[model samples]
Target chain A: MSVTSLDPVRSELLAELQQKVERIQSGPTAEPVATHPALSGLLQLRAGGVYGVDAASAALLLAAGPSLAGAWCGIVGVQDLGVEAAQTYGLQLERTIVVPEPRERWLEVVAALADVVDLVLVRPPGPVRQGEAARLAARLRKRGAVLVAWGEWPRCDARLTVAGTRWEGLEQGHGRLKARRVRLEVRRGAAPPRERELWLPAADLAVRPVEAEQVRRVEAVPDPVRVVS
Target chain B: MSVSPPLRTMTVWCPDWPVMAALEELRPDAPVAVLENNVVLACSPAARVDGVRRGMRRRDAQARCPELVLAPSRPDADARAFDAVLEAVEELSPGVAPLRPGLCALRVPTRFYGGEAEAAAVIAERIVSLGVWDVRLGVADGLFAAEQAARRAAPQDVVVVPTGGSGDFLADLPVEVLDDPELVSLLRRLGLSSLGAFARLPQSDVHTRFGTHGALLHRLASGGDPHPISRRQPPPELVAALALEPPLSLVEPIAFSLRTTAERFVADLAGHGLVCTAVRIEADVDGVVSSSRRWAHPRWFGTADLVDRVRWQLTAQPAHGPVEAVRLVPEVVEPLGDHADALFGPGADEQVERGVARVQSLVGHDGVVAPSVQGGRGPASRRALVTWGERADGVRPAARPWPGQVPAPAPATVYREPFPALVVGAEDQVVGVDGRGGISCPPARFRAQQGDPWQRVAAWAGPWPVDEQWWDEAAARRVARFQVVGVDGSAWLMVVENGQWWTEARYD
Candidate 1:
């Protein structure tokens, strides 16, 4: 498929803006969307802003807490998302909506989903124009819904990128993939960046702050680090 | 005030309602019979035309009409199908008293529509338009007489007895119409053939012979009302209403405007030391209630919970026009002391409750679900997902002893769809479990697919057999589950049923 295929569908943002422009009053003080209790202070997401996560694993880690807390999460345009892995990371599958393909109506689909879901995770079908991106942000603000982009997004409340990760449970080329420890770097809008180590896919369906001893043991393994890092 | 005369009633009756309800999907004129306890309880008009009648044996009815369709009698189905008819009649008049699945009665407003006959005609027109062609209407001085009058009316017709003619009208009817077959038989044996003959006997003599039951029957025979209709007081309007000038249709904006009203309503109830558990949300458009539904909360409703209910109602119900007003009425409430918050610190439960409520607003109601354990043989069947804030009443109880269910310490995550896998022996040949509850070989390795590298089994448990529904040929199943732990320490629940291997759940 061509990357620049265009469909003649009208932008929902354009249609919504054409009507009487009454500002929708957001409830409360726009508290950040909840993250895992272990990473509560490390990550925050406000409405109308795009948040970035490094890998699909990191995104799933970020999504689990809010989902279990009763927030609905939607995954769009990312076909290879491992839902089984996501469940192990603490996601409530029953409350999750997976639309692996949004096609050309990506913007409209995301906006309509924003009206219903608390968080939307999207890897855009293709490059998004600046104007269309702005309109999408506005809708998110009006709806008090957060957007977590897998790839690059223009304006974001905070951007999180995983620096490195190490997997456990595998020994001497045997055993299955079980859990992983990850070092994540958080960059908030112009604020000084910060870093934290966490168990991204905790085997017990919980993400926790990585212990110093465990980090050291994982770092001591030079052979697997070269292969994974 | 002067002594008021007994109120007259108008009854709408549908014959063989249960049979009709069961045969609703069939052709309207199809010949169908409803059987109860091996006897024909009711039959369609087409079946009746072919000599099938009530009280006949099922075999006799079928023999009389070879094309007769037998439908199992279901009172619940009849009641559900009759709801639409009741709603239609309620639109015309409000005092609808459901006598049974097939019959309902309401007050006769003789003065409003000029006379009893005209009111009955209007009601008949409304019901007929709803596709119930077998509807019959009857108007008389009392409910008992009105019901009898309705039975006398032909299909799609009405019967109206004059104001004081109930006694004369009921006089000639056979005692069989009393509906007590044994009493009718006894009266017939005693030489009382008609209601008029039974009514002529002294009331004291009847009481002496049959007690209150017989006296009540005698009163009905004489056209005296068996049960007097008592006036019912109107319910108090506890709803809080907010009128919108331009009327809002969008859920967010409407929800925004409703926040204050909902909060204030909650506050008012809280002030009275009460908390609402169920609330009725109503939206009006063009001066008529466009939508109204009662939503029940799992626990007491907070301000945010109330607002979420209003939004959920708006989104679920497609309104006819822009909403002109919204109202919230507390349907069920409890004392605040019973649900008082902790004084020292915020309760974890209260926090979770608030978070769930907030999330319910962000997502639709179906967007949030809570996992519950249920009794079943399979991993997926043992788990039940309940929508947040809904009662988990219908799920099977987990306390029942499941004969072959996997032992406790259930997997943390169960795959919604089991993953197909292949379990192979040391030779890499596919292993199998035979019909004699024997493993063909000791499995040593497994893989989800051919290209994927096989994982060696570190430890394994028995392939406990589960043979269910063996008596039901079509639904019978023979499966065995094995808990296999890979060298990596990741355990899986694998099932081998009918020579197919599938991964049911993953344990971490």
Candidate 2:
């Protein structure tokens, strides 16, 4: 063995230690799952990580990627998730299982679905406790599956929030809604929030990044503050 | 070996029996027509008298008979209804061959009923006693001549051709009795206008000119029996029933006790080279059915699946009192060979199904669902959720262009039930939609509930009219929709129907 190298007579011992450290860091990892084309540059979804989203649409968007890539997905505790929107967002409907209103046993349902499906999207009945999330996280790492939570969670690898939304095709009273643009804020561990402008849906029913100067840009100035003391 | 002649055959016919079976659902006097593919298959006598004929389009038939009620042709229902008639006829004859739903054939009795005419009359009287009118009977030397005679017999009457007189009996019948219009027209042009004339032609020439089908028809016209009627074997009694001694009320005890019966049920079906895919389980409490449900399997069911269906049914709707008996009736059974596993097995679907079955066991069956889209205008009506592990039946097709449907991008959050909301104008008057698609006032502020804080409207669009099922008064719906953006940059899909406003979905 080289003098500077850590390898010794028992090289297997170093390998064992390496595995333990990797397990502590993230337990285990599965193949990387595809993300929405619009978020490809902004986000890379890895197995064994739970992502939290403020809106139902964002959760649907996260699941759509893996689902469209021939992966099985399960939805728990979301009774009103529009399936048409999910399909339009690129999820394959035939592979999606929805457990609406899982009431008191939602965590168990998520755990069960985690073992079977590649992706599980659950809207917890209430705010999740830290220990429960850690337990679920261990299971996720062991099972090599991803969890997308639509509501409050104490432990998350990242959080996506819809900071602002703008409708483009509607006027005062006559025109029907045709397209939408949203300002998204992505927050990760101890980092400054990253802001991105994207089309939630374009006039042609496509979702992608908004192009520069295609339409007149509005300043989006904040309204005057009103306070009564 | 010599081929044996088919025994002197008798055919019994009940005219318009498909229409008769469908008429069970309507008033007895209502003229009904059963249609398949918009063509009248069979019509009641009342409709017939009004010029509603078979093979006519439904619109034409309805025009001919203004009060004719229409029903889609249900072959299974027709078969089920005719099963009773077959059994009634079977009681008089040991071996009966069913020709179709409305017709059957049997050997003309020589000993049991004494003579051919006596047997025909006895069978006719027996069927009429079952409340099925318009049954006619005919006896001849062969099945073909017998069927033709049955067609010629009047209602509640029987026609008997003298012994070995099948040819003379069918002589006067036209060549159209062959029932192939093309051959009938050719025969008519060839100067053979009746069965007697066609029967007089040389058999070898007819065979050379018209092929085997023509030769078979020539033999039939000559009253020579070549086709033999095969009698139907009665279906086996496969229902398994278990009586709970001392009447157990708890689901666990009932389930535990019924295991042997479930095993036996599966075993019996296997013994007959069949597998049940759909079974109806019934729990009887004090002689009354307390809980009954039909469970279906994507593939054929096994012992465990049968047991699970029994347990789930009992658990879902518990018996009010102790259950005295449990019965399992197979609804849809297929040949075992059709459902056998392939050499390579079913692959990934089997694994996924097992995993889903585990989830279903944990949360009970209906907790998991598969989502699909259906054709409708309203957000709630457009989406359909089917319980996992069950067939999606009777779902309205989604391919039709549903006018007035909410445009995409569809709302991500659709409320299962409309959440009540208040939409008001600048004057605080509640906004409403009139019948003619006019808004009483433009919506200015809205709140989810009465005590919740109101949010100012930023941008708004309006009044996509939806009027559904207008002809059905009780189920009719009239509504208008609006897309309103709140000051917080959130958007909502609000609906107004019957002077009330509700939030139906969120653009979130």
Candidate 3:
């Protein structure tokens, strides 16, 4: 078929394929994750599970850098990100430029950064109203910048849905080493919810997925194969 | 039936004039005394208690306080320092005039400045706020009357001499207010105990006895002559001092302080539409002070010149210790005319000045110099060294010429010290001649411990010879100077004949 003659069918199929690819890419598939050690330890805890939604949002922002290059990324409805996650990512501590206090002069600070900064990672001062968020997003878009609105983004183009999970067989002990298991649930781009089990070792963030077949093999092996070769 | 009016003018006097002496003795900070002849130079309220009045002799003042810290007056220093005070006051009024060294007269039109009392109070408050809390302010219709009123006013008080009431005010004032001791004694002999009694004397009779002096006193006593309040112009010259805390080390802070002081000093000159030809910076290290090697530049001074002089003074400061304070005083001021061309042409910028200043600051002031030509027979004899950025102004006779000196069209560049030269051959002969038939000298073949290489001679000129200053053996050198054009097309003045070839100058 000539390139121009295949337009209609091609367009339809390409749109469908794009949707499928995005769904699959955004889904809960086993993927290697890089995280600093301190954050990995906190995530291993059972009580008061770490907010997976905020973490996933931050990760998305980091990945979408070229699109959101010089934008005001307002993170709202999330005090946990402001206090811990942002610092863990080295965003708050590594800044060499002027760090203005975030209070009455937050808008002024934004104005001052209009010419200088690339990405402004801000946690909003108050609740995120839909109208205010929309206005801010419009302004950011007009400025050719992206807005990675975290927490309660009112009218976002992309969203990462998170479900809580707990680790099993992990206990706080006096020994230097500890091991634990975790379950993750993620849904994105209209994909069905998926679950995965992973092992988190002390002092490391290498998440090794525990396969069902491997579990069966362990059960079948029986006491090191009856102590035979 | 008519009613008599109350007294409109009242004088407030300090009963304890010697309190200033007491304050000086009791408190370490008190070096205060009343300045009477010149309006209250300074006074400690303590001096008032012992009646050690302003203008009193040192002996009389001591008798009163017994332990008075009697500081001999420094009117000039006080006036220079008071420029800062006057500048601060200039913000209030444009017509401020110095009535005396320590006293300034500010004229405020009563209509615009509320009333006389309000104006006086405002001025008094401003004076007190200047950390001079013991000022006695007086307001009157004219300068003389106001001054008299101010003198009679108590410390920290404001006395107002009402208009049209000068005659009544003087009625009770002692005849001693006449200012002349002879006139006072004469008036006392005439049984005139008060100015009111003195004014009753006929002017003709007063003039006959005291001549012009008596006539003047009679007119003043009667308030017939209007006190001429001529505006006292600002000083023709300016001097400023900066007191640094914790002393200073790095040149940057000292330069910063100097920048501020120089700005003020220049601004003061600019106020009079004048400029300074010479600026003297005196740096006080500990208690000892060292003045700068006086530098004369153009009328208008740049920040670099000021900084350079300050740096020079500071660096040259004896090892007495770090400087505790610095005083930049402009000693000579000349009328600024329309001369735009810089002393060093426009090509010179602040950076060059700053660099020169930095060098002078690091090394001694005499270490950095500009080339000056002197009258002499030899190449070195005609050269004199002068501090950078200063004009030589006049030609100085050359001390003496070196024997066998090279003639005129002297080398364009002369090194202060001769660098060791390489000899091509043992005797006056050329060796190792290249294909071009050029002789390679030392530095070309022979190298110094540290320096650039010398090139071979090309088209060399004759060795012009002259011997001079043989009388002073310590300051004499016999050199056979020759001008040689190098293979690289660079002309140099080389000396030979003593079996040693020294590269003296270069003309590239």
Candidate 4:
């Protein structure tokens, strides 16, 4: 679908993804990650900004590409992030590490991870204090790591909200749930927001950009001439 | 230039180090023997007093000392524990050269402590303070003479050869001191009972009779080093420093603060076209260096790996005081080009390494695992899972030809904990396998537990009998595996043993 026609969530995600791409492109390295061009911008985690993601599925959709393309990604304190679904999204299970819960040491844990992990997907157990968030942001920047927050994060570089979702495989409750289409809204730092629609999990378990189908010509009236008149 | 003997080298020897390390956690006075291939390799003094000796068969040794605490020879364990001794020696000297797990050498620092004898006493005192009561220190012109002097010294003592007197000192020693059975026996047959006799043989005659080994032995007996010391290149100028503000008390904060420094440390190594295989980390609590440790990495330390080591070192214990400064030193480095990228190009999954590392840090190291295939007949036993950054210890060799292993197309999912299930026939009776490896009935339904509804089984295969460790009654298992496909397209490998059914693995 056209970027504007996407539901709010997808538009926001698209705008954020585009802003990352623009920033990476303007820098010395035009192409940040060479393996997965589809995830080039998403993997170039700019320092000092916490980027928010709306759903685990949407997060995996953005993550799987870069993860498979050699970027180290971690899910911290995200209890229900399914390893199986993550594998389906093309992530090599061998390389993925999931920390379901990090209670009191959440900030320290994230900071330690920021040193090594290229991208960290965190679900803050509670609202983080301003100073704590700022400290985390500064660490990420210095370490050149990206923090992908599952919940709202203050002063985020970008935010992607999942607006709508549709599953294609279920046939009246008989068939299994399979392919999923999601609309993502992207809001980047001071950039005009945009949208994108994608298969959150394509038939083959890879995220794919969705293209609008060509509008077919139809006759509203019984006769074309009558309709014209 | 005047021909001069090699500089005097000091040797520190820890007798029966493997036995000592093996019994480190055990009673200090226990009689112990370390075995290799069922033969005694080394034994404690108590075992020796009990008539147990090295080279004795396991049975013979046990007969000699029934209460001997026998242990397998663990070279790696010995080396790992001996790191403490190395560190202790390193505290006294900067250029320590480790000869083996129990022995090390360093140039005698006569100027620092007045003379070689005083230098030996200083080192012995340092090691004794570290709780190694039986340390022996020896100083001589060559490494061999020094090692021999250390071996002959009484426990908790030092032996120093007078300057340029190693040749005179080694003359009367038995030829067996060389420890080469063939040479010793041959020399004895030739009526040469001492090193002096062997050394007196014409150099050309010794070369003609005993070849290179004999010539080398002659040189050693005449007070020459086996090989001239090739001094190492001075350690590279690579140190990353971080000065903490207000000195951090918590390990996590110290680790967090040093993240940038660690990254720069790795980057600096990379800039010099080098990769560090081993690194030394030092934290200054106050003005003086408080804690220092050397860490070896399985792979060259990347930015994250270096940071992980720093965190591990810091968190291993809470510092007595706030950490004021931290420094990273590359202990061992290799040329960057030595590690050729994979021929097919790097795997896109390098990100998963970071993920695994992060999870390990949060969960305290054992939280995340990568599954590996290993040799075994059972579905659960065939899969080996290893925590990240650790070697797959205890894994059965997958290369061996296991006669009755479960045939592949291996299961997609192996339950970490097997689930008990009911395999029933049409009559609602539980399906089972008899002792003769025959099925009691065809499985028609499968239910996980009593309350769960029985799901219709679509297709079935196997009843493959696996009788493992039949001779070991307590460890024996007799099971028949059946691959049953459910109506929902899910397939499971179920086992029937001792009238019990278990869901072992799943195919997704």
- TM-scores computed on chain B for all candidates: 0.59, 0.62, 0.43, 0.64
Model 4, residue B475: distance off in Å is: 5.9
Cα lDDT tens digits for candidate 1, A84-162: 4566567777666555445676566577567657788888867778798788877787667788888877655678886
Model 1 misplaced regions, further than 4 Å = A1-30, A45-137, A143-229, B1-7, B13-83, B90-104, B108-129, B133-138, B143-373, B383-393, B399-429, B436-438, B441-464, B482-494, B501-508
Segments in model 3 whose C-alpha atoms lie over 4 Å from true places: A1-229, B1-43, B51-64, B232-297, B300-508
TM-score, each model? 0.50, 0.56, 0.32, 0.56
iRMS for all predictions? Answer: 9.7, 3.2, 37.1, 14.3
Better of 1 and 2 by lDDT: 2
Q: Candidate 2, residues A188-226: lDDT per residue as tens digits?
A: 754578867778777887788877665444346355222
Which pairs of residues clash in candidate 1, taking residues 3 or more apart in a chain or in different chains? none
Residue-level lDDT tens digits of model 4 in B381-451: 76565555665556788789887776544443466667799887878788878878667777777775456
For residues B324-425, what per-residue lDDT tens digits would candidate 3 score against the true structure? Answer: 777766766655543333454532233234334433444444444443356665445455544455445344554454334343333333555667665343
- Candidate with top lDDT is 2
Tens digit of per-residue lDDT, candidate 4, span A91-182:
66555555655787777777766666667778899987889987887667665666778887876767877655544443321233345555
Query: Lowest summed lDDT over 10 consecutive residues: which window, candidate 1 chain B?
Result: B346-355
Give the Å shift of residue A201 in candidate 1: 9.4
- lDDT winner between 1 and 3, please give it: 1
DockQ of 4: 0.06
